[model samples]
Target: MCPVTVFEQDGCDLRVEWGLDGVHALGPHCAVLVVVDVLVFTTTVDVALGRGARVLPLPWRDERAAAMAEALGAVLTPPGLDESYGQPGWTLRPSSLTDLPAGTLLGIASPNGATLAAAAAETGTAVLAGCLRNASAVAAAASAIAEDRPVGVIAAGERWRPERTLRPSIEDYLGAGAIAAAVTGRSAPSSEATLAAVSYRAVRDRIPALLGGSISGRELIAAGVPEDVALATDVDVSTVVPVLDNGVFTS
Candidate 1:
């Protein structure tokens, strides 16, 4: 057997890994894939879905994002955040989605979460968005969807700028841990998954503060969107589970 196969945690009912590489390693072996990008991507999805909006996850720099949104009749989110903070229009910021009307179709873009979700979708596995706001809900949904099959959780870590390499973000790990901890009773979790859950439980009370101080959260705060971090850290406030179906996330 290939060494890569060892990392799959094939015998476990629940698995966890970070980034797109995790998806490539574990997507094939799992029945459900949960993508966690707590800083923004998945958190935005939860908020939007809770308000009865559907989301189309798109790559951050994909030139086709607008065209694809037009083709799907969805509102394409702005690619840049030049003037999005505290504005009405949608970007990756979760606060802008507060008043999002029902039945809206939003094409949300991200470098981490959206990319991992799109990759997991290609594996033909069921993909669900998980984040701090809706961690418990997503965990239950993913567990039920798996139906005794393995479920893989992918933490969409931030990219180191300039080089754009993976920079594992604590917020994403904690979000993944939240979901994993929720489902621990239903399935046997891999060691990676267990560590995440344990870490989350250890800091469950300080999530908001930790998230605000995190590298990703600090960046957002410095960018004039502190509300984004605040909203993202609203643990268990949302019960929405945004599942990716046919290239869109609804309910």
Candidate 2:
């Protein structure tokens, strides 16, 4: 029992941790891993899945992303709206996929959510995309996948630019908390997980305002994409649980 292993939350039926470190720490011990990137990533997945699109999560700036999309015959989502590429296709922004058609295969990239998700998948456990939009649904789906085994929820917090260090965001905390709260009664949760749920419950009704004023939310608003923040804070409005299958998320 290395002291570091204590972070794995061993013996807990539900555990919560933050960022890529969390995935690596708890992924192997849990039967199911839920990645929550509420400001965008997982929210985007929920929006796309709800619209019937299959989403392939790719690490941000992965050189193989284009090749992988080509190999899978999926549309490689643009990194973001570029004036040079007028009317660009889907992007990491949740609202960008609102018109995604049914049966579309989209490869989406992210530094946080997708990176955490890919790391979790390496542990060979079931991986799910969780967010505020689909919190309850993802919790139910993850519980079913775990079948009483441990379920690890990773809040995919943003990276500090340049150095790329983890910057925990309140939005993701609430998103993870929302899912953890949904599983409160049935699963024995770690203290970390329980705190998240408690925090979420304390501000459940003010989620929209809290998210809008959160650092990540403010960033999106400053970037003129406030709708993304609004969309991500919908709070259990979607029932679609984007489960990762064969490296792609399909409801």
Candidate 3:
């Protein structure tokens, strides 16, 4: 008989010893769960696709984003990089948030998304990347691979340097809840997640305020793209899931 184990935090089992260490420790047979909470990586993919701009992912900052874009005859812009982070090579573009050039590579730094993307680079399959903006689409893509297994949902938290009392944002949980409801056919595990999506469902106006507390939400606001987050939280906005292909973002 197979033994039973339980992880008390969410009433979940140990689930194969989570964390990047555990995932890499396994070496093989690790199903990757990518949760992109920054809202920039996933949302930009969705928005660009929606507006007919092709997108890619640059795992590092070494001219790759620009090099790939130039090779594809497109313009590149860095959304997550900041002056404090010592950005390189035209990291900020005035036209990025609105006018994304086709074949653009979005360089992201969310620890959660990066971790899952790395894991997906290993397995090639069973690596699901998702956000609340594309939650339903991600759920559908994941369901195709899930095929009777509990898929991982890595929550990409803040994009800043690690702090002592760091906390996960409501947006991540809200996105997780949406993905869970779509994939698990269950309600949100907490009021925050439930209200996040449900509130958007009930009133289309609260999304901006709800997202104002998110990691990217504040940055976006500071960058003068607050409306982007509001636009991102719109549920079922796209048909693309934006999976990680050998470290790049692809549908």
Which is the leading candidate under TM-score? Answer: 1
Better of 2 and 3 by TM-score: 2
The backbone clash count of each candidate, in order, is: 0, 0, 0
Arrange candidates by TM-score, highest first: which order?
A: 1, 2, 3
Rate residue 120 of model 2 by lDDT. 79
lDDT of 2 by residue, 180-239 (tens): 998633557899999999999999999989999888888878878888888988888999
Model 2, runs deviating above 4 Å: 1-4, 80-87, 184-187
Per-prediction TM-score to the true structure, in the order listed: 0.94, 0.94, 0.65
Off by over 4 Å in 3: 1-32, 52-54, 60-76, 83-97, 103-112, 123-125, 159-166, 184-207, 213-216
Model 2, residue 200: C-alpha shift (Å): 0.3
Model 1, 1-251: lDDT tens digits are 33446778867888989999899898888889999998888988998998899999987788888898899999987654434665667777788989999999998777888878888999889999999999988999888989888989999998887898999999999999999999744557788988998999999999999999999888899988898899999999988989898999999
> What TM-score would candidate 2 get against the native?
0.94
Models ranked on lDDT: 1, 2, 3
Question: Which pairs clash in the backbone of model 2?
Answer: none
